[model samples]
Target: MQMRVSDEDRERTAQQLQHAFSEGRLNQLELEDRLEIALTAKTYGDLLGLVTDLPAEHAPPVPEVVELDSKNGNIKRSGDWSVPRRMRVTSKYGSVELDLSEAVIAHSVVEIELALDYGSAKIILPEGASVNVDAFRSDWGRTATSEVPGRPRPGHLSVVVSGKTKYGGLTVRYPRKRWFTH
Candidate 1:
């Protein structure tokens, strides 16, 4: 028996077709044809046929754990860096800044473990990303999020922050929007 396809299935197929086109795997005409058929697909088989000739989508391999440490200086990561699945950041009397607005995030969820003393950690997330700090413990310090939610958003990245801080601060926020481009 042929299984029926849902709207989500059709949209996913369409996105795959678009990705193939952008990757130079499909020509403009081919993409259009596949997209039209994908949009009108009535069964899973129909949608599957559209992308059968293309290479399978594969996510980049993420390291199990990445460690970032500092003792007396600031640590900063920004501009198109690859995000690991799990990260451990340690600092003492030094601030840590992670800017993920233009990062290459492969996973749907990211875990960050922090250890700090007399320093602050600032995380800047991309749009539509959510962060949770429920597992974080700060003694003589505070954890704050600005204009971002603690729960995960649908079809968006979710960040889980955990660890301990002593006389330090943790802040998570989205990038600032610019109204004008020079």
Candidate 2:
């Protein structure tokens, strides 16, 4: 009997392909070819072939991790970087900023652990992505966010900001695009 695939399965395959591309395992041409196959795959077996040779998501050697200390001054991470499963942000007298607009997220939800002391940190995300900063707080400073997103649809990526800070501030912004009428 022939099996069938759901829309969620297709999108999940596409996301996996994108993650492989970001990890430099797949070149643009290879990624495009695999994406085409994954999106149009009819059954689970077909989709499995596309990522069979790729690394298993569950057993990735180590989560991508970036760190900033007091000496690094203002820190910024942007462009086609892969969003690790877990990220640690430690700012002691320095500011840190991370932009996830063009990033390739490995998992459905990314976790960020923050530890700031007398410094500031900001996380900027593209529209459509969901972020939960509910577990964040500052002692002397404050936390500001544009707007918390409602429950995200399936296949939507999310980020969870947790941890605590003292004498530091945390800000989260989601920039929505506006189309102007001619």
Candidate 3:
């Protein structure tokens, strides 16, 4: 699925992250790592944790929760049954959290989508799971790519968003399973 981040939310998230880094709660490396992720977070929910680390002034609070049941499951049961992956977020505009541990698939496939309209957001994937992420960025032509456990495929898969958000121009698609788009 393709996720999105809002303009107003991104600005506020940066402020909050700076506060957390300055507060001594997050070391330089930790702050940098998390800050980078928060700043580029495509979904407002992705910034949830990053924002929470900052001072209260950075991120206020909001009340909301949205969940999407797994699309399908059917792969032959692996010897072990590990918990699915989980993702959570917190930021100035609001916060959102999710647990994918239960999203295990036996064989078939599952798809999900999220759009950032308010704050920050994040995604959690299982070890063997695969993902395709195309994020929207302001850089003239900066791009990122990496190899997760599973092979990357093509399909639409989006996520919940927050605050003054805009498309990074990037979108994620599914390969093995059904994918949702923003």
Candidate 4:
């Protein structure tokens, strides 16, 4: 019996091909060819063949969950950090700031579970990235995501921000543009 692949499967394969190209494992022509096939592949086997030859290291293992816990201090993450598939953040009386503009994100969807009390969270996403806060709940707090859309964009990262906040607010926005560059 043959199994059919979903659009997500095809997109994942294409991302893998792009990663391989960035790592120098595949040349421009090879990347283009594999991407074309990956986008059109209708079966798992067809997609698997595109990345089977690449080194295993090229595909980093995604952790099940990464926890960022803070008690009295701020939790700040920025500058080329490797983003996990799922994250749980627990903070009390401290602010949480995650700047993912230059982060390495491999997964299509990133889940962020926030448990904040008397603190705020600010998530800075990269260009083309979208965020969803449908599952997020706050008590006496506010959420400001007016600068970004709530739906995910094709071929881009989608962040799902969930969990509860008390006496604190949540802010999701893109990085600020630098006016001058040297």
Number of the top candidate by TM-score? 4
lDDT of 3 by residue, 106-175 (tens): 3323333333333322334444455544432323322322234334444422232222223222222222
Candidate 1 lDDT over residue span 1-182, tens digit each: 03466787788779888888889999999989888998998876577678767775621123457788889999898996668899999999899899999998888999999999988889999999999988887889876545679889989999999988898888899998889878
Worst 10 residues of 2 by lDDT: 58-67
Q: What Cα-based lDDT does every candidate model obtain?
A: 0.82, 0.74, 0.41, 0.83
Give RMSD (Å) of candidate 1 vs. truth: 12.7
Candidate 4 lDDT tens digits, 1-182 = 02467787788778888888888889999999988998998866577677768975534234457788889999998995678899999999899999989997889999999999999899999999999988888898886444778888999999999998898888898889889878
- Pairs of residues clashing in candidate 4: none
Taking all chains together, each candidate's TM-score versus the true structure is 0.65, 0.59, 0.31, 0.66
Candidate 2's displacement at residue 50, Å, is 23
Runs in model 3 with CA error above 4 Å? 1-3, 53-182
Residue 172 miss distance in model 3 (angstroms): 38
How many residue pairs clash in each candidate at the backbone level?
A: 0, 0, 51, 0
Ten residues in sequence with the least summed lDDT for candidate 3: 69-78
Q: Which prediction has more favorable lDDT, 2 or 4?
A: 4
Off by over 4 Å in 2: 1-72, 176-182
Better of 2 and 3 by TM-score: 2
Clashes in model 1: which pairs?
none
Task: Give the Cα error of residue 153 in candidate 4, in Å.
Answer: 1.0
Please tell me which model should have the higher lDDT, number 2 or number 3: 2
